[model samples]
Target: MAKSNQTKSKEETGASRGRKGDRADEIVTAAFEEFTVKGYAGTRLEDVAARAKVSKGLPYLYFKTKEELFKAVVRSVLTPAFDEMRDLMLASDLPSEDFLKGPFLAFLQDLVKSRRMLIARLLISEGHKHPELTRFYYDHVVSKGIAALRAFIDRGVERGELKPTGLHDFPQLLVAPALMAVIWRSLFEAHAHLDTDEFLKTHINLVADAITTGNRGHETS
Candidate 1:
């Protein structure tokens, strides 16, 4: 009977975890919809609960606060993207130019396919008002991105694949154009349609030109 009880307990534990995982996913998905529509400053936890169809207290059970929920939403959207990027960084036995033209390019391409782009637009729109959210975003997303870029740039410089530039120290510059493109797409795409693929190609060309020691052909395609 003791052995049978242990088996029951193990089954219950696994089932509980499965339910929690489902609830967490529902909460994050609901939070994303609300946060995108209302922005961080304007969204309410109550609304997230409603959209999730969970009890009013269920969100609190999963996330301590709205900011934490927002972070979870960002994480759910970004973890896969950055996981791919981090893995790419790890396997980067390539030149800086090729790195940019390859894995970095792949990340940018994936960016357009995910909800991280929406989260990014929220960060731009409400980040000043919610400094904590901005800080969290930078601490998790921006900092990792910059660190990866810095390492790549450093390696490029050491191997003479790239010219010595300020970007080696401040790799944040590499992400600026991508952010600008996201912002433009969020705000003005409806007003004046812009070709995102062309924009990304030009941006990559400009960055590659700035970093490459010799004349390089633009091949973002």
Candidate 2:
């Protein structure tokens, strides 16, 4: 009888774990869509579970609350960008001009291509009401991004290839325009017949020109 009970316990444990895994994946997917469409306050766990085709109680099995689930979604969406940015920052031995232009453009391109653009905008729009969510993004996403950009900019200044502006604001100045462009395209330009690639290239060139110093445009091959 004891052996039969032990076997039953093991089977139940495995089934519970499988259910937990499935529920976690479902909740993450649902959270992504809900956050993108409804923003933080507008989203609820019951709604997410319904979208995921699971019981409303199922999401709580994976995520204790909506806030926790949102954080998980933010982390999931932002991790790839953070990894790419980290790699670009680490590969600093490349020419400063190429270093600045190459990764920055690639980053913008990825942002344009990603679904997270919508999620990011939603978070930004409703950030004040969900201070913890905003704070999580600040601590995880924004701080890391700013640090990487600052390191690159500081290197450019040291190499004499770029002008040294106030480092505090320099990081934002370098990236904000690109971010705004993403927002505009995602929110408005979908209906307009705009040449996105051309616009991106033009914007990148303009930004690079503004930051680059000296007569030698021959810095990078």
All models: lDDT? 0.81, 0.76
Q: Considering summed lDDT, which 10 consecutive residues are worst modelled in model 2? A: 212-221
Tell how far residue 49 is off in model 2, in angstroms.
Answer: 1.3
Of the candidates shown, which would achieve the greatest lDDT relative to the real structure?
A: 1
Cα-based lDDT at residue 206, candidate 2: 76
Q: Compute the lDDT of residue 180 as modeled in candidate 2.
A: 72
TM-score for predicted model 2 compared with the true structure: 0.80
RMSD, every candidate, angstroms: 3.7, 4.1
Clashes of 1: 0
lDDT of 2 by residue, 124-201 (tens): 688778788878988888888888788777777777777777743667776676677677776778677555556666
**Model 1 segments beyond 4 Å from truth?**
214-221
Write the residue-wise lDDT of candidate 1 on 61-145 in tens digits. Answer: 9899898999898788776677668668756776677778777876776686456788888888778888998898888878887
